[model samples]
Target: MTAPAVTVRTGMLDCIQANLALLADRWGEPLRHLALGAHLRFRPRPGPDGLPTVDPPPQTHIRQARALIGLVPRHVHHDLEPEALRALSRRTPVVYAVGDTHDMPWLPYAGRARMEHSFLVSGEAGEACVEDAYDNETAWGPARPGRWRLPWEQLPTARTAVEFTAPAAYRAPRPAVALDDPGPYVQAYAAHPDRLTALRRLTSETWLMARARHLHAAYREHRGESPDTHEHLRRWDRLTATAFIALRRAERGRPVPDSLLPDLAAALHADREVFAVRDEQTEPPDPT
Candidate 1:
């Protein structure tokens, strides 16, 4: 497959995900499969209830993030070292830490909140130029779909420790084999609670709810009064409610009824479209 073109620029997580999509394309697999495969590898067996489960290690996000970016991350908790500084000086992109939103005076959460986060570091000349989606603000609140950049020193060091690494060779179970047996992916999705898995589980009710709410708000504030936006929200809400029911049934080991399968499938397709990169390349459908 040709390289997946970049989509709308966004914050750290979204940017990482976008980059992952590109890398997954390079690896001859879908981003969702590559990401879910990483999470699944950490937890490969079924629990007592016959559902898959995993005891997530500290900062599982790093692993999922790295998987999505197709890189092996190196964690730096202390101050930047000489070697690290030299690495950042390179033309290649890297990840950098931005302590908390509270520490960022320009952000809405300034003086009020803190969220441990990181952003992408692009080209570095005398000072590194970093890009982040969080810096962009709109009337409703902080919105994504756009990105901005500034010098490296301008960013706050919230979590003095952060993870960084260059892209690595893609290594995971073959896509066909993994999809044929989805025990690992299912378990990984339900067992761990994080943004990475949530993004990977595109069909899950929780993921749909979060994405729908964000888009719903954006439409109301930014898109002006449009019946289509309202209708979209209503449909998303209805689908979200039903998906939650399906999720609950699955969690309880109760089989999802045949009647709800079509709706669930539709929801998945809609979710994909919302974030789908509409380029010249034809992509494969979700196997889940």
Candidate 2:
């Protein structure tokens, strides 16, 4: 007999955030604040290809974000047997960080390359019901949403599995602070000493940054003040595309234009200006 399939809506660009959002939705909690205060910073690290890469914010950020919704994430690195995973799934959807995507048949990189990736497993009685909602362009190809079942024998071992569990006594969500200022973040990005390298790193790390922008936009829209927020989203989308194009050109030994970083920075500054103007317009008249 087939296990009952769980229905989960597609989430944001960040895989972990996407799964967390789904879980938050399941628990009837708010998640628009998950990416609040998301900002751009140049944290460089060596990637698998032995080249410098941009690192996302520290794990503390994720933990803090989860705590806002009264959920705690436990990360397990070893003893990921199928039965163990199945038991975890019985309690909550599991987010698995697959070190090598080549073994996961549902991923675009399956049988083609090894890419570290994450996806959600929603059910696992007879078989593991997998839901991968990551739809983005990658070196392999465009990865689309996929819902498939992995038999118990074929469930690949995960490098780490994150399980979000609710405490017996539900904790009230903390009041969310409105992070309306974008000036500092934009300034930091503009002032990066090694922008060309930063842009190169962004080619692979755009998902998280883009996810942050998307969430901020959603939060603004929720507050019914999103005119400038939409522009911020558009500017970020352009930056992501431009960075990818630059990376591809450099890969072919073509000269990456010198104006690339300056031009992108200018666009971000323009976005900041829009936000500044909006804030002024919305501010209450001084009541002194």
Best by lDDT: 2
* Per-residue accuracy of model 2 over 98-206 as CA lDDT, tens digit each: 3357777766678887655666675746788876656666687776666678885566666566766655555433213222333444444446676555556556555
Clashing pairs in 1: 77-161, 99-158
What TM-score does candidate 1 reach?
Answer: 0.41
* Structural similarity to truth (TM-score) of each candidate: 0.41, 0.67
Model 1, position 263: C-alpha lDDT score: 51
TM-score for candidate 2, please give it.
0.67
lDDT of each candidate versus the true structure: 0.40, 0.54
Of candidate 1, the 10-residue stretch with the lowest lDDT total is 173-182
Pairs that collide in candidate 2 are none
> Model 1 off-target regions past 4 Å?
1-5, 8-58, 66-69, 79-93, 105-107, 122-125, 133-140, 145-147, 158-168, 171-288
Q: Write one digit per residue (lDDT tens) for candidate 1, span 1-288.
A: 012134322221231233333333444433332233221122233432333433222244455545333555565554553345335446334555435656554456656754444444444455544444432332237633323344555556534434455464654322111112334444354456552333223333333243424433342233232223345456656665555555556667676544443553454345343333233223322222
True-vs-predicted CA distance for residue 125, candidate 2, Å: 4.6
Per-model C-alpha RMSD: 12.5, 7.2
